[model samples]
Target: MKAFNDFADRVRKEKREHYSKPVSYCLNYILVYIYEPITLNQLANMVNLHPNYLSTLFKKEIGVSFSEYVQKAKKLMKRNNS
Candidate 1:
């Protein structure tokens, strides 16, 4: 169990680094939007940020709003399903 826990911790750390490296709020938002299925307000709460501020940051970094990002992700999911 200890070894399994260690392995899980390592995997989590690597995943966090993979997401944090590029540090694009939009990408993070998109990923969370697709995989997590939470509201914008909930996501903002998770990150301890204001929803409007997060929205602006996402736009600045990704050149699109969170809604657009989620739409693109959903489209990709649909394409993959076929």
Candidate 2:
């Protein structure tokens, strides 16, 4: 029974991690095109998330505002010559 409980816990953790990856990837994808001079509403529609929800998730996971994250990602990409 203890082993079964441990397995369940591990699976739950893995599932959460898997779900989080796509959210992070989506943020990165959005950041990549953020410089194209589009409105926030348009980007939100493209990503299929509510603008408010996307803002909250971006802040929680990336430790910054969405705009800030885009700046940081652009800086890092430039540093890496990407």
| Per-model TM-score on C-alpha atoms | 0.59, 0.54
Q: List the residue pairs that clash in candidate 1.
A: none
Candidate 1 lDDT over 1-82, as tens digits, reads 9999999999988765453222255466556557567566776776777898877766665567877878888889779888
Writing each residue's lDDT as its tens digit, candidate 2 over 1-82 gives 9999999999988765553553566665665675565444565776788888877776776567777766776778678876
Model-by-model lDDT, in order? 0.69, 0.68
C-alpha RMSD of each candidate structure in angstroms: 9.1, 5.2
Residue 52 Cα positional deviation in candidate 2, in Å, after optimal superposition: 1.6
Worst 10 residues of 2 by lDDT: 16-25
